[model samples]
Target: MPKGEGKVLAQNRKASHDYIILDTIEAGMVLTGTEIKSVRKAKINLKDGYASIRNGEVFLQNVHISPFEQGNIFNHDPLRTRKLLLHKKQIKYLIEETKTTGVTLVPLRVYLKNGVAKVLIGLAKGKKSYDKRDALKQKDMKREIDRAMKER
Candidate 1:
């Protein structure tokens, strides 16, 4: 299917408001058994999650996958860092892109695709306070226009 097509389990709504997403990449996640179970249950928190490239590899940090209820002793840590699977070329590009100031890698959403867990990571640039206000104004205008059109 198309990129990011799947049942979205969790989304970081604040990420969109805090940063301007320039591009997105879908990457598979390496999860333990219990971790996958938790993900399937939609017990995941993408807030405070970010991707970092280290030692030529990408890792997802601060994403909380709640421990499975029935996993008992087999439950994995809720906030453990998870490895992200991306091609070598993609990693290289990300490494280069993130080197720029104010640019960051933020997890936009988590979804299940074909029974596998994937994370949609966005290349984002931080929004200034004025930029945020402008965005809000634009959204309000768009909403007003849509409402007027719908009532016509």
Candidate 2:
């Protein structure tokens, strides 16, 4: 596929910073017509979106799929919870892992795959304050090293 033609819609960069992702799964979302159109226009946000299992089903909440500009009063809510289409086995496994480890399910990305909308969801555990600080320090160290190497 061409680079610009096959573009990514939205991503959650903060999820990696705030949590340690242990597993990732690709799932489909149930979107309305206007929502799909809005997504095609790249009007979406997944930063605050998260996934959760309810009664054995998976749902995504806080994700913003902006309303289609041409739509009137029929537009779907931007932050409404959307159902995630995951396999039964995958859902079951995530539920078990979350229950055992007290981890969470966060939406890592929302993009198109082979012309279909797909969401990359991660199984993660929240990081401690020190862990975030350590990560920042490491990032700074790497930046400095890269600069030194370029100057050498």
The best candidate in terms of TM-score: 1
lDDT of 2 by residue, 65-135 (tens): 88898999889999999999999999989988989675999998777877778888899999999999999
Clashes of each: 0, 0
Against the hidden true structure, what lDDT does model 2 obtain? 0.88
RMSD of each: 1.3, 2.7
Worst window of 10 by summed lDDT in candidate 1: 1-10
Q: Write the per-residue lDDT of candidate 1 for residues 1-152, one digit (tens) a residue.
A: 34648998999999989999998999999999999999999999998999999999999999999999999999898999999999999998998899999999999988888889989999999999999999999999999999999999
In candidate 1, which residue ranges exceed 4 Å CA deviation? 1-4
